[model samples]
Target chain A: MPRFILTFTLLVVLSAGGCSPSNEQDKLTVVVAASAQFAFRDIAEEFSKNNNVAVDIITGSSGKLTTQILYGAPYDILVSANMHYVEVLENSEKTHGEPFVYGCGVPIVWTMNAEFDLDSIASYFCLPDVERIAIADPKNAPYGEVAVKYLKSLGIYEKVKGKLVFGESISQVNEYVLNKTVDVGITAKSIVASPKLKGKGFYRELGEDFYIDQGMALINTKTTHDLKTKFKAFVQSEEGVNILESYGYKLSK
Target chain B: MIDLSPIWLSLKLALLTSCLLLIIGLPIAYALSQWKSRLKVVVESFVSLPIILPPTVIGFYLLIMFSPENAFGKMLGDAGIQIPFTFTGILLASFIYSFPFMVQPIQKGIESVPDHYKNISYTLGKSKFETFMRIILPNIKRSVITGFVLTFAHTMGEFGVILMIGGNIPGETKVASLAIYSDIEALNYSAAHTYSIILLGISVVIIIALNMLNAKKRR
Candidate 1:
């Protein structure tokens, strides 16, 4: 019985190895900011189907992704939440060439609270019922940075600073927002508009003045495959723009 | 210069967690040591669950439980007792995550007291509380210290639970571990290095001190 089991395991392993080469050249690895995760997933899927290339999408805060790239993580492309991180990567000579604006993300005030006054976003923070407000960590998340800027512009940054909680990324902020752990959160519109979270909560756009210009760039590496270029082109293509638009992103082009 | 607040915050958290655990864990450990029921096994398992479970698991559940959307959380919220994103929240998290570290050692210490010493005290008309305080506690000095130090160090190194619930608020929840994480994420390598070295130094000193104490006890 043991010998038969061993033979069966050996046959299975051999068949798995026989079906696909260990190092497939047509595979592309794309790292994206957490806020753009859902939109990029669809873009990658469509690109994969059209080009017959496998695409792997990794999601993280733009700053974290840039740090990984700086440390030479094997990623083919980066879809940053803002232009700043892409510029940082470019300054560090981590990119193939100049980065391009892929989309512009609108920041939004999102809440699960039925009694939340969306119109009085500035005043809402001072309310007794609203105890905690979540935002992405401004240090690394562009959405968080913009949120802070928005508050500061309204001259209420200091007043509401005490109630703020910083999530590591926009995705973490979404977790707080959707779970209703926080009374409200400042996050990318793409997040609340994404199919999974759509209609689950109330979201008010923070206006075009608070938009973040999302950036994309190919990583410079010895393993840079043609599929990487094809993937980048596909993201800027009309189909990709439509997907981004559906997710509440405005096309820069 | 890198902010020294995170290091201080970590030390504060560790000190508070160990101190709080000492107060809470002593009675529980003592009770367990005297307990001989079949259910004791189940109780011990639950106490030790934090040690076995990943911090993220604890963090996730704690996050849910603290959210106002949950019934229990709403009750606390109504009472104006908020937990999420506050220093108090992280303190509670550290207490749970470091429960076994504080409990197990002291429990063993109590159990190691020969059955007769406790009986002798009881026979002499000493109350049960007095007997535990004077006889059992005095004998288990080593285990008590071990439990305290272990919990302190463990809480200092706590990351996942605090991350999920802490909200990375400066001067509140941004202890050394989370500070190091945020620094690395922001590509502030120098700040990250400074925090890492300090933590590494503190951790090594604690382990060495613990070993010396144990060695002296053995002697």
Candidate 2:
């Protein structure tokens, strides 16, 4: 009876050690840009449905993600909103190889109230009643840079200087407009396309000159598995382009 | 040198929030100390909810509830009182975020007060309200100060809620924490470091002062 109990305890310990799920799933961790969260989620779900592998996707600003990767964040794949961040990682020897342009991002002017006309919204910058304008911080966010460029193109950069309220990310900018915390906001076209902000705000597409060619890269130095290679191929495939296009993002051929 | 506006805003927010929290938290805490019911336990749990929940979760709820299209938000808008992205919004968020910091200490202090003091005041023809103000309150003054210091310090370091609700508008909603986050986001590590060190120095000074005061009181 004592022998049987000892054997049972050994079996339990072995089973517990052998079936630790977190360690088993370590190879599947993929960090992408915050803007690509929904798209990556869809793709990751589809990928996981056929395969036994689990994917842990962490999302944040491209620059922040790059910083984290440099600081030894356990990230396998990095889908950025701009090539500059990926380039920074590559230049710093943090990435495996050169980055690839996956999709292009475009900026849009969004507003919450129906009181603002979409066509005449550009002129609203000159209006005294327009107290606040929301945009992501240009220094780190790609969409913010485009927004600033668009404002400059319209010669309203100085006019809207004082009223400009900055969000940490593109989603926050959308939230600011949706909440009516700001009179108007500049965010990505994909965010404007979201059903959550559909009726809450009006949007105008900025010109292609204001668009950014977003890129993705695999950090080969850190990942022990072939996750970087697999993810890179998957993202560059036609399937990924379809997902990107569905979200109002233009894919680069 | 650092941009002083955000620091000033943070200090103002901390001061106002601590004052408001003390006013609201004191009575609730006093009542909670006297009560020993199942409902009291539930209320106590609710009071500490902010401390347990993530700041972003609180900010999300605050954003929806205080948005101009929502019921409360619309009412405020109709009344010419806007909350979101304003100084008032920062104060409201800070107050909610630091509520338990104000309540828990005060509750413990009130609970520690001897029942003899209240009984004597009652026997001396003092009303319940008068006894609470003159007797119970004075005895728990240390806890009240501790609560204020804690709430103020927590408000000074507030980030997630203010970032979500206030939208980081300069001279309005942008506080020191948000400024630090912005500087970090911008890769301006030097500025971020400067602001962070200053904030750290201020917090350390406040905490040391409070500890010294507490030690003196004990002696």
Candidate 3:
């Protein structure tokens, strides 16, 4: 049938064209969650320095990126904030192989007040002077969902409910804390670990067992590229773990 | 379950904001209409600033401005009056965001009236405020409605500034737009769909009404 021939020809053409590249082997596209942006940028930079491939990284909330992928966005790999999004792609047979757990994200109560330093997160909540708290919007941000769980587990979500504000992402929450627009906010440890924001605030890791597991998937597509596979392996390698740890991600066993 | 709370919150905000803008915008627009100076262009441009800038750009600065670290925010904080994450913050942000929508139409409305009508009223000994109430405002009723509708609709769809400055607390800062966004993020497409329909209905109704008024004016 023409339909079968059309599908076959399209697949062959797609495989023949490696990401609309200027050259066949030089282009790779990876979609990274907003939370993993800095780490992935560094990883991609290092990878391109050694390999001939030029990597392009697209970053946004994992859910939004997942929606884009489902709509046939030409990403070679997706690094999501949690496993749920990766599993969605896997269930649809859109992933080339099994997704791997790379890191565990830690949530923290961060503050910009110079004098209000504490080693624990609980006290930051009860400070009478601290009226406005910040967290990522819980619906799309895994860190926000984890933040909500951590607050509830601590038995303080209700009491602190009135004072809470929501950011669009972990990065915005970092801005709220660093600008002191909020008294304290729950944010990803990775944000504070970023070199630009490091030492700009006081943070106490929630260290609650409710960490969001980070996942990466090699998307199934007609494009011929091994760079995403290499980047994935590099992300799980010892050097990758070291780089992630420096950016405040807990190593996954 | 169908939650009407966010929709209700959005209406209440739009209602309150439009009312405030109507009360506050008239005098400001009036002053701008009659007053002319070398700095008038600067003032007019300042009023038009929100329309040109991206909402997030304004939202980001407003978030910082409302922070207690700044002088303005510090004063508010010292007064036990917090602006960030509050309805007041949303109202303030909405007022600034929707200011042009309110002012421009009214300014144009006031300008549309022929100067002879006001002069005729003045010749009969009508005061400035009296002339405005009797002569200018009567002719500009359509423009006033345009202002209110545009401001109301603009506030109803406000997302960026509210998301930046608001804490998204339920029944406080979480308006319908924010609710719909969070619903999409939660993968609750059905709820988001419902909210979008209602919002779409509102926008359709508003545009229809405005067109009707505009049509009447043309006649």
Candidate 4:
């Protein structure tokens, strides 16, 4: 028992020993919305290469990320899928400065099945063979909200309501579509357009008019870090914009 | 104000899981209690795996196994049996997740029933099934209740597995725990609080009632 205790204590100490101040100071941790995951991965890599800094990107629903920010998550910046979460962080006085819109996200219907018709999302969803449809949870995810709105606008929400399944975030919706867990999924166009997922599935854009304006803000209100500032600027830079555009994000300006 | 549908869904799931576990656990528990072999240890450990393993493991396995792209899932799909993102999917997940809670106690209870009781029943010309239903079952009443209550409450506390496969469909797979989680993420604290308070109240009531019943049985 004494030997076991010593081994356990040693393991715990070894696991918790990674907090060197120099490394911590040099690293920039950014929390990104799930919809922007693929785009941000490329952006983070480019920014890290250009600035010679290690950049960490954590991804989840914007609302979930905002809650973490509010509760003192150590993320240096948040790239949200919408401005609503950014505003929530701002209202809580957790922001280093005013939130800014970085890009716009367009929703798309995606499917891994090659035989499934994708021209008309509404009619396709109403089919008897399309048993399960995946969507992000509209209560927290902006992409999910847009998907619900799109379905409602087409007057097929009630008709196809029983087939809908809610993923906690658009990333999960992408997973469902990629893995063929659901017949199809409503997700951000950026997902299917990502280099890793591009051409792996079929996708139909739900028009450019219905788009979510994404937001970005620094969370370290006390003292803004240089790397965080550089990252923010890098995301808005021409190279970053190009990378995002490659992943199907629309620039507002 | 809160939507009570999630709470009702949770109760319905828990009730069904509890009843189903009871029907399924009894024979296995009995068999395990009577068995005396090296393989019994392996089977017992497998039954108890969920207690130690994280719910996400089960969720991931369920997702992969039931995906329409997989052979097993495709076979089921061909038969028009859908599992993922449905109430039935979550129910099957819950059964695997809460199996140990329903089985272990009943096995212990069956083991505690002395050999003389069964021997006497057999001498009286009672069949093995009759002996188990009358002689053995009566002796393990407390164990059965413990197993039932634990399974019911454990099912209520299930979040990770449900979150992985539930798809958060209202009045279907969206249970109270998932609702509270969504409410918190959406920053609807009031609704989260209401659902939490009710879940807490019910859990406390169940545990207290269970303790009282156990104490009375002891007396």
Candidate 5:
């Protein structure tokens, strides 16, 4: 059995070498959204243990990664913060199959130094004491867009406009709060759960109305059929859902 | 194709930051050149700290220092003057980030002025301040101009520091570099390309003009 397994591995390696000059290594590369780094890293390590494939995870903002995919960045899979990019890629024929809703994201009002009082937050908007409030850039980041929506719904977008600070990503928004650059920050709940912000800060859920539906898709043109199917199945499995849940994300029912 | 806001903001920031850096940097540079104290080494090292450290490190420290909860920030908050996420914040970060560009060139200029000229000025009954203003400054006019142009260009290209502090607000703190980053990140490549080309063009023009000014000064 050991000799047979070694022969099979050698045959697979030789076949991969003959298949393509560029992709001679036959590794499965997955591009994930930067905010999902911690969760994906853990998942990828576990997945790599049982599979013949080596996973390379490239993390960045979903919009930026989408643009990179459009510009022909070679990746087998893309996990994004919003489903819009997956739909865009599907329409553009970039994905092998339909995008799947893997998890959902929740926005949280996070503070580094103190527990945020939601009841007094509305009054704090007009207060002279609260100088800066950090949010992700709404244009490219989903969490920032949700934060903006919540602020607009509360009718204080314009009142607190001057005191707003925009971070490039959810991680950056956490950095702004962690460093005390902003009095309070609205970021992804995943960021608030990270070890960096664990004891230093606290977060309050922004509710389902402001939730962002995070999704994933396999890039059809660049990926192998077997690897793509494996990745898709892995993410939809019970293990993936548990991992997502552990990261402060809700699994899509 | 012409979104003049970033261009205008970049130029305005470059001009304002260079001017302020000159006011603050020149005296420090001059003092460093004249003095021979152990503290001078420490102070000079501090002045060049921004140049050596990564811009993000400087930006992060500035973010904490200027935020409303910090001591300096609390004082400024009491005065109705918020620094982080404002145009003033961008200016301050730009000044610190680009300090060495102004000071180093001017320091070299000052150091290159012969001690004989200073002795001659003193012999003619001129005070130290008057001698520096008249004799030393004029001889190093080219260096000062070079410093100003270099500092201005450096400020125009600032990204990490400004992004950390400026809040990326349009027509306020959003300079061209940050705008290009935003455009690229949003998949608006056409806008990003346009902004990048314009930025490159402006930088080239400024560098060429500075060169011409230097050539003319030399002649």
Candidate 6:
């Protein structure tokens, strides 16, 4: 009975491998941090139009994606909001090589309320109607860690801790802030620069002191597939930096 | 990736919820069963609403009510008490979420009992409370146990309401279900599997116990 079962399993595996089609080869999957989603989508769309490969971008909290990759999730590239996750993966030999910095992540305090004043941003927590403050989950998202750091830097994290609501991702934080569930949200500057979200809220950027860089990495040496390599080359090209800059990413300085 | 804290948290939450529901549910169920007023229908509808109302609906409103800017929350705040993102918050959400589960079964049992038992005990010089303890209590023992077990299992599997009210703070409010979700999100499938199996096993055992108790009563 065991022998028969093993033969059947072998047959199924071999047949499945043989039946795989060319469309699978025509695709490249890139996992991205939620904060870099909009710009990466733009890059993927542009890349796919010129090249015949289907560029699939998966976005989530960078830490969560790193955990996934470490557990052997299939992906061609990983773009993280924090270079730290990439560095960990590279050290663990999960990536082809050391990750390259693509852009600096900028933090911002955004409010969808038109009546709110951005002048005294540090003291905005004391505003009478400022009830909930939404930030990404600091344990998993880089923007969340920066939000916590920035709040502590301003010396108000303790006072405002009670009002804080943590979203699972920066995208979720944006939703909570935009829908007025939270009076203030800490989000990425890239999100605010997106055309759909621009001008709907007041935003003040956290300066150079709070800046962190986004890192892009080719997954593993086995990801040496031509299409994946081409995509990596295209992103590192000067035009790719320009595209990132247009989307509010500071390539350098 | 794997932590027994979620299991312990879930057990603690379920235990507290079931015990509190028993104490809190009895009076409400008795009042609902014995009330002679026309508006009792209105009150009963309010009690039964949680059973039909989606967890998300209750969670959304509870989240709003618990917000510091809101009136109810402000009242709690003035007392130097906070509800959201605390163990107390989970306790409160569980009480409300599992109230109907505990109350409905007992209420049905109380409502079905004839007036003669109470009347007969009352004529023998027993007070209302004494007659309730002596007569009504024993008659409805099976239903009360069912209510407790049902509430226990229901609270164990509770996810959405916990998500909205509890906010997944580890050790404080991250119960087993949310822990499983966090595990899977982080791609820790093994931990997720372990948590899921534990929940599934415990729920089936509790439910089977409930069915056996009910079946014994029927026999």
Candidate 3: give the clashing pairs. A165-B167
DockQ-based CAPRI category assigned to the predicted complex of candidate 6: incorrect
Q: lDDT of all the models against the reference?
A: 0.83, 0.76, 0.79, 0.82, 0.78, 0.80
How many residue pairs in model 3 have overlapping backbones?
1
TM-score of each: 0.53, 0.52, 0.51, 0.55, 0.51, 0.52
| Candidate 3 wrong stretches, greater than 4 Å | A1-253
* Location of the lowest summed lDDT over 10 successive residues in candidate 2 chain B: B181-190
Scored against the true structure, residue A175 in model 1 reaches a CA lDDT of 74
Query: Could you report the Cα RMSD, in angstroms, for every candidate shown?
Result: 18.9, 19.4, 20.4, 18.4, 20.6, 17.5
Error of 4 at B27 (Å): 38
Tell me the interface RMSD of model 4, in angstroms.
19.8
**Model 3, C-alpha of A136: deviation from truth (Å):** 14
lDDT of 2 by residue, B1-219 (tens): 767677777777777787778879988898899898889878999999999999989987887787755578788878988677677887898999999999999999999998999999999999999998888888887888889889989999999998667766556777889888765543356788888888999999999989997998889
Considering the two chains of model 5, state its CAPRI-style docking category.
incorrect
Q: lDDT at B169 for candidate 3?
A: 49
Best by lDDT: 1
**Model 2, range A1-253, lDDT digits (tens) per residue?**
2353355446535533442333445245566665666677677876666565677665557776676565444467788888899999898787777888888887788887677777776688768889999998888888888888888988889988999998877756765777688999888776554443345567788878888888888785445546666766776678866767877788755
True contacts kept of 1: 0.00
| TM-score of chain B for predicted candidate 4 | 0.98
Candidate 2: residue B7 lDDT (0-100) = 74
- Candidate fnat values, all: 0.00, 0.00, 0.00, 0.00, 0.00, 0.00
Pairs that collide, model 1: none
* Runs of candidate 6 exceeding 4 Å displacement: A1-253
Candidate 1 lDDT tens digits, A131-179: 8999999999999999999989888899889999999898778877877
**Residue clash pairs of candidate 2:** none
What's the true lDDT of residue A242 in model 1? 90
lDDT of 1 by residue, B80-178 (tens): 876876678899999999999999999999998899998999999999999988888889888988998899899989999987777555566778998
Please give the DockQ score of every candidate, comma-separated.
0.02, 0.02, 0.01, 0.02, 0.01, 0.02
lDDT tens digits, residue span A115-218, model 3:
76666466667678889988888887788888889889878888888988988777667666776889988877877787766788788787758787899899
